[model samples]
Target: MLNFVEYTTQSALRNAGMRSVISFGIALLFFAATLVSFQVTDASAQSACFERTALMKHLSGKFEEAPVAAGLAANGSVLEVFSSPDGVTWTIVLTQPNGATCVMASGESWMGMKKPKKDKVS
Candidate 1:
């Protein structure tokens, strides 16, 4: 009788362990599927124009100072520009609001211009 009781208890524990492992495996599969689906959706949702290399290339050259503008990002980073007095060379700078500054791009033949004066109001 003691042997039979012990065998039944051992079998029950083994079944419970197997069930737990299967449940864990299924949970992992579900999580992996969710991640893959999110990646697919995110890749399709992005715009081509926002490609990093294309954007960097497009923004690489000189810009007319009067029309080109800079602003603060939502995350408190700053986009700005600096040019030599002769305006033959330019440097684009990105300054984080935290006081860190970096050069984004630089090039020769940059042109600086004075802002156009508005006509006097009648």
Candidate 2:
């Protein structure tokens, strides 16, 4: 049973013709769920969600990723970005109010913004 968000997410991805990317995301989520069941105590591990620590550890270990940025959404959910050292891989995660964490998205070739140089006084 797909929730509204899930249904719409899939529909949007499919409509955008991101079939391969969507397939990869689904596979990653399933794999994460499988690993989480063994690593986390959360009974809801069947839904590709788990404790933040467990899921983060898996992501960090698998992809060598570390948190780079985060912010609170209007709904109170915290969104975080984890990126690999080489900037070749990244994942966006959402932590719900109930403490459940799930991968919202993942991809490769992620680059961060560059800081502007300061002007010298003449």
Among these predictions, the greatest TM-score belongs to 2
Off by over 4 Å in 2: 1-47, 115-122
Model 1: lDDT equals: 0.68
lDDT of 1 by residue, 21-44 (tens): 999999999999999999999987
Report the C-alpha lDDT of model 2 over 31-90, residue by residue, as the tens digit: 999998777766534456778999889989999999999999999999999999998999
Q: Each model's C-alpha lDDT?
A: 0.68, 0.89
User: Worst ten-residue run, lDDT, model 1?
Assistant: 47-56
Ten-residue segment with the worst summed lDDT in candidate 2? 41-50
